[model samples]
Target: MTASTLDAPSAGPADTTKVKRAAIASFLGSMLEYYDFYIYASASALVFGKVFFSKADPAMGTLLALATFGVAYIARPVGAVLLGHVGDRVGRKRVMLLTLVLMGMSTFLIGCLPTYAAVGVFAPALLVVLRVLQGISAAGEQSGANTLTLEHAPFGRRAFFTSWTLTGTQAGFILATVVFLAVAGLPDQTLLSWGWRVPFWCSLIVVALAYIVRRRIDEPEVFQAEQQTRQVAKLPVVELFRTHAADVSRVLLCAFIAVCSTVFSVFGLAFATSHEVGLSKTTMLLVAVSANVLALVTQPTLAVLADRIGRRPVFITGVLGCAVMIFVYFKAIMSGNVPLIFLAALVLIGFCYSAPNAVWPSFYAEMFDTRVRFSGIAIGTQIGFAAAGFAPTIAWTLIGNSRTNWLPVAAMVAVCCAISALSAATARETYRVPLTELGKRH
Candidate 1:
């Protein structure tokens, strides 16, 4: 094994108050950031086709709408490099608060955008613009939150603490899905006209709540001391590549596991509620809400387990399990058997997928030192996640003659999961590495 940091740099110990503050801030910030992001996902699946792409055939319009959803991924890598630089160079706290404000403004503006009928092609064009902004905001949110929380956390418990960043994201996904579930229940005319906008408009409220909670978190002590000593990297991305290139590449490949998540949540929702499947929007939405609620519970437990064992074992288990479980999960969805769909969703999303989701914040971040942890994770994961951000659209295109024939889509997920598992298997185990010693070459 490589030796830990000895002479490169050193920093202060954790504080109880700061640890609590960082986790709370990370949770609420993640909740708010993803709430803004997923609301767009829900809208693309349920309402955007009719509102913004009505000129096309129904099936084609849904395809076009989902295409717009993928547009955000194009901007995420750009955001990752830019915001990741700010987080690593300036301070994590600054980027944390900046992302929340940007997401709030963009999301609420999406609520106010005119329909295609009102403005011809400009409607979809403007929607894509705002969606790009959301993508940029998200690129930095979790990486900053994870870096901040991990720095503030007690020794030997970093995984447990860093895991909350993802748990907050689950809460955000649940809250966004529940709001859409209610809005999805409205009359078609009313739903297409205004119900969808309400969720986007409500993003302002989430922003305010997260601001109050997030503002209380100070910069991590290690980061502060490094800056005061003028030891911070001048360009985090360049330094990351020069010193930690292999880890960054590994994280990019490992992030392919997110394909399982987007396929299960976004494409699965669209498929179930399509005319071919004939499942109720309410039923599909409820399946999502229930599965996510279970994730909120299981993710933290899995994170604690990673702390006890090792990050690689826990992460590898989740990746391999998701590869197999995705087939079963979709098989149940295609069957139109309500009980079976619920059971499969609970297992695939709640436990199997949740394992990697829970552990990845720490698992990936531990690969780099404080100088480039945020940049390493943001650039690597966002580029990899670009595949996930577009997975729904790809899966939709992968569908065969009948939407019910979803075996091809399941096969696609298994391919991604396999690649992700292989990438993760090569990563160095870091659950036992001290925060100060991480990423240092002995």
Candidate 2:
């Protein structure tokens, strides 16, 4: 019920000041990074269909835009491998700084790209290139932030501390939705032309602030010790596979839980706003902003509960809850009940999905040793998240023209959440484990 009942620190108490700094850094950094990421998501849902794929029918153009959303996921695994190595072999702070700058630059450039009407096929091609860069930068952002924060946090409150990384993520989504909400109200031409680009351009300011905050933080002592003693893995990916292969495998499956998010955020938005659903773009964006706002509160609260209980029960329960809630959430949209959609969105994502989202930063990070924590979490989650990236396209394709086509999308979400839950069920309960003893094979 309290910190006193939880596992005591294996090492001496981490500097409380550093722990606070790490939490704030992780929070602000993830807020900015995912702000860059999700604004693309908002655009792909609302703006990119017209901007880059106008040659296709509106429906097909939307699909192509969603496919471009998946393009980033394709590069995410590669980024994870590359950036994970840097984070593990170099230092957490370096990867943190590098990822922020990369995301900011790529997102800003996306704002500057020419549209399909202006540049022919090269429009989407250029979009894909920058999207891939965004993906790569994203590969390292959360894992880097989670690892840095987890390592710095006192043992008893690791979940609470690491949870800020995801809390910031919820804030990012809210911020993006709010920004998009403002731009979405512009007249059609302006909305599509220069209005959407404003959000992308705004990422520069976020990047500058996050970089400044991150620059002041130091790497965790555990990591610095690895460097001073030359114990940093020469190839963290290899070390991760050799030592923690099962954990990595489990985490990849567990990370499938992200499908719930993409389904709720990106796909759900597209579906709700489509002609069939007839919801206004602003309405759907409001649903998103509302749920994410609730997530800001729920994630931290549930994360505190995770520390008091254990990660597995809370995470597994939440995943299963999502499986059920997503079905209801989609049904709410299909019914064209605004009040119902709002409730479902709040519960499905704000609470049920937020549980797993809040916990995974600490949950996944605890599955590896300090030497390979970044690589292991990065490589595993990014690969698994690729499924999430394409879930919108798959859901859209699955739920074809039938007005009742929402079932397949909901079912797809249920299945992924089920897989994620089962994976967590098998993981070691790390809440009670001393920080130094985490990831022990036997």
What are the models' TM-scores? 0.96, 0.97
Model 2: per-residue Cα lDDT over 116-201, one tens digit each: 99999999999999999999999999999999999888877999999999999899888888988999999999988799999999
Model 1 gets an lDDT of 0.89
Pairs with backbone N, CA or C atoms under 3 Å apart (clashes), candidate 2: none
Candidate 2: clashing residue pairs, number: 0
Worst 10 residues of 2 by lDDT: 1-10
lDDT of each: 0.89, 0.91
Clashes of each: 0, 0
- Assess the local accuracy of residue 122 in candidate 2 as a C-alpha lDDT between 0 and 100: 97
Residue ranges of candidate 1 with Cα displaced over 4 Å: 1-15
The lowest-lDDT stretch of 10 consecutive residues in candidate 1 is: 1-10
